[model samples]
Target: MADHAGHCSSSSQDRRSHFLVAAYGYQGHLNPALALARRLARPHGGGARVTLSVAASAHARMFPSSPPGQLVVAPPDAEVSDGIISYVPYSDGFDFGARPRTAADRARRRRVSAASLSAIVRRLAAAGRPVTCVVSALLLPAADVAVEHGIPLAVFWNQSAATLAAYYHYFHGHEHLVAAAAAAYVGGADDPASVTLPGLPPLRVRDLPSFLVDATGGEHARASIDSMRALLEIVGREKPMVLVNTIDMLEPEAVALRAMRQQHLEVFAVGPMLPRLQLLQQTDAAGDDEGRRIDLYEQDDEKGYTEWLDARPRRSVVYVSYGSMLGYSRQQVQEMLRGLRECRRPYLWVVPRDGRDGDVERCLMEMDDDDGDGERGMVMEWCDQLKVLAHPSTGCFVTHCGWNSMLEALVFGVPMVAVPNWSDQPVNAHLVEELGVGVRAERDAAGLLVGTELAKFIAVVTGDGDEGMNIRNRASFWNQIL
Candidate 1:
């Protein structure tokens, strides 16, 4: 194996190839699917041939160089709609105000959920296998297409299975269990700090991540819930191979019970998906001298972040982002910038473009009051986020706690300050703080993050090793779990 250490094929080491409907306008949805694509492509040691047939144009961008690669671009025939499920070719990716994502936009993004199953069916007809296996994000045409083709289709739950189980239980007239808990703790507010399901252990509302908490407050939440419930119903009655992006050990009980009821459960524990999958592949290919090809997502950007990092100082900066879906009001955006500037911390913030016609760069500078360190607060319209976080100068992450970012922060053993806006964010933030890996921010009774609270949290993360290192130590311990 040493003779051919670096060379590898993109043929997917798995003995069997599988098709994946990998398409999403936003980064959060797109990144995990890419991670799963990478995982499936690597050899599973049993000579199982696995090739991920991603079904979309945006997805094609992710695997541009990787092989056994096929991207089923959105055909012109498929139309777009405002309320219906369809893909509107977003020449420009989704953008919210220089703030967090709004509820309606979140719903619209999820609504543009066209499953290009027709494309996949045709592809198989041309050259691929019988198309027996498929994984999807529970979109409309997903199961219908799979059924038409007589293929076994699995609704890949991108969120935690625990979250799915909660939704299932919620539909069974047991959702109040959470409403009651939220009422009891956060006082009828959507911000339920801790939630416990009947006959199940106590799961923090934060641990459930943000969406479950905020769904009650917004319109997108309803559409997404409808989608999730429909998905769970399909999984509930007829078991399609369910693929969840969580760990067996971390969420052992939930995983166990999910498999108990469902006949076809293949819980990969394959998460923190990007890095954990890499770990498994690296371990499996430990001493193999075979030629292996490079994975595309890990490829360097034009300028290269590592090179950028080398020019910056050690642990001297803060990272800020509201994730891909979350948007903020212009008012909230101002408060956030004021907080960052007041904190006196040099930061790299992903300032959101104003909704429709907003300018991203102008927003960042306007957010700066003092400009004490001109450009000390670097603003990137869109970033190679993973690479930026891995930079040594990055001391803390002020994030929306998307599953991908949570895993990325942990992989780098980087400390974080949490400000969960929506979806699973609240849950992610709670886990980040509760795990001792990241510090938490205090929000008011109305759930708005106080400016001082944001600044204070930032100071703690960028603070000295005595405190920050302690958080990093806890973060490193979790990294070991991966």
Candidate 2:
């Protein structure tokens, strides 16, 4: 392996080399990538010139003042040091316009983004800030550009190390078993079979990522799986390092299997790269001074939820969020509302409004409280998730079990009632159960979360019973380590 430091320091210019970290524009992918970029550009020393890049539309949504197809350094924020790190936008075929609503549009955006990224790299190199390493967030095409320019590319696996290992094994040799298990699970309807991967525990067919084999998974899901397979193939052939957002202790067996079937494979567990606030508070540091959070959606004031939480009893509030992209059907949304209303617990739910679907809004209007003070439950488009998780009043989390949200729940020692939507969430939910940190709620035949089941699971995890206490203790143990 070539030493990266050798390329970083040149005789003519004795400065830190550049690291260009690119995320795929979704909130889940961008947050971890941004945290990693911040680490690379840490103020004191032993840091690099980090420039974070994302799709043009996402960049526009993040910074509305900036125009698309232009590369401009981010204006300095008081909390973020200016020169240490910067953000730039590149064309992803959506020039600050409406987001892509179809698979063909998404595919075109990916192709154009690849070309635009290559141009960005060339321009950066020409300007004397050659990128020493290109870190990509699950986007394989970016790696081709890096290879073309003879620069090392590192994949920042945004999901858990265990999930990555499962995907790798599936591509390497376990396809038949996984596919059969998925089919059996889909066929069984009531009681499904389990798929036993090489390094992980037995996962129910429902727990498998939808992209791998689920027939109902749409084009986007299929495209994601296809892209992931291509990514692993690139890793297998080119042998670039894989950097997973996980810790070794959390998934020892999975981490051990990181290089089981692939040659020249090197994997590093360098994460739980949470936001600045969560990181500081969890580390017992005094700084509560919040910095700019890498959120794509419009967010409410961070203090509102924390103040509301402060008034509640310890471990009494349920924090609910379904991530940035996943959307629920009208039936599903209504069921969740009914569950929260009947659960009789104070809750804070971040339900992002979907412009395409009026059902969510209709349901919200139907369930609006007469008092309008949000006396029992509060719903907003967005909230500071990390701050809410860290609050002492946050007892349980009702989450989609996306890797980032799952990690936040575990790190904060909050028990979970997981309602996994799709794509690696099932695996993450299973891991949560296996680790004894949380419990998975049962879904109906149509995979809709039942109001009764949601209430039952929430009560199970938040109740004052031995099982709940045990789960809480296990969560706390992990949080302490984190």
Candidate 3:
């Protein structure tokens, strides 16, 4: 195994493998990408070096104390080790703050990032440690940059293999079918019927990615669709070996279709990439040395959430969280609060400070005061979510169905009540329902979750009912497999 002190040895240094990993700026995308990068860089006979590259704006958020830059290595507050993994920040046009709004802005940022990443690859090659291969996480431009540097490219599919197959078919053969269905549904303004892809399970129109079914998403949706198509097209031409965050036994059909050479692609199921929690059980052969979690936001649990959780009975607490980016309307917030109150379960909720903190804080205060027993529910800005999920008290997770969150829920054997907002979340919700691991909460036509429906599903999933028992058993079954 290689250590920081071994950097001085010539033979040991010569044997080190180097991989350049690039991920999009979003938190969901970065978490999986970095986790994979860490796994690749774990201690071994021959050492490994990983370079995590991200857009400048995201870099700033990850390490807010770092100075502005074009292409810089080891910015202040970057979590880097001497001989293991390192951080490299790149320009995405919007370096200071905010994401690309329009297609032109997105394209411009891609161009800038491509040039900067090419430079990083060149710099590494110039230094005696050439990058062996480039693994990109949802940032399609990184593939072109890797090719330009005369290196092999592997796309890290940040979502599930099922979603991968859906996109794969969309670009290969099912484009017209999906487009026509979406158009017809849009015209009728009726609930969309389920659509089937080649060699895959049937998916409701709502189960498909929002970019495919919802035209009202405007420029963002169109841009996302274009990027997804472009990514598949690139893979078909380049024939790069793809890596997905799923296992073979879990989604056999999707994995088989993914590796079909007839489509000029080969895919590998290499993940469920997660933080190996030493407290519960160890998954990797690396023992309990899982190291620090890769977090963009600093988590300060001033409320002692872990202590609160420690006092709860086993499998008694409900954990609720939307992902990093999703925010709720005030009405929806009240509905969730009402549902939690009605469910009569001990709960821990994460309420982010995205303009509605005051409302959420007030709600939490009211809920706390109304409790005859102390602290029926706890709310914090953020905490170590993976740790919370791994806790014994965590029985159910109320999730946004983001792929990372779903993967964690599966790992921890926690059933979910999915509240899908947009993007791939709806597809993941469909997967949760299809897999029979959990049930989706019912929503109205406008896509708002009803309080009574939320409370009812919570009772059904958490109570001793037959359906709840089945879901719980399936969740425990997957946890053992994972």
RMSD of each: 8.5, 4.2, 5.0
Clashing pairs in 3: none
Order of candidate numbers by lDDT, starting with the best: 3, 2, 1
TM-score per candidate, in order? 0.74, 0.89, 0.88
Tell me the deviation in Å of residue 145 in model 3. 0.8
Regions of candidate 3 where Cα sits further than 4 Å from its true position:
1-16, 43-47, 60-79, 187-194, 258-260, 279-291, 355-374
Report lDDT (CA) for all predictions: 0.56, 0.76, 0.77
Better of 2 and 3 by TM-score: 2
Kindly give the stretch of ten consecutive residues in candidate 2 with the minimal lDDT sum: 72-81
- Where is the poorest 10-residue window by lDDT in model 1? 1-10
Which structure among the candidates has the greatest TM-score?
Answer: 2
Candidate 1 per-residue lDDT over residues 1-482, each given as its tens digit: 11111112123323444454433334566556545555544444232223333333443443343343444344423333222112222211232112115666544543333334455456545664444355665454455566566666666667665665566666656677766665565554454435665324567655554445563666667656766676666666656655667776656656565533543433444455564434435644794312222222233342643454556688777888776445565556667777877788777776544321354334555655455443557655456666566667888888877767887788777788887666666656766766688887877857677678888888777777677768878877866776
- TM-score, structure 1 vs. true: 0.74
* Model 2 / residue 35 / CA error / Å: 0.9
Candidate 1 stretches with Cα past 4 Å from truth are 1-17, 45-115, 126-128, 182-194, 198-200, 204-217, 252-268, 275-308, 354-363, 367-375, 445-447, 465-467
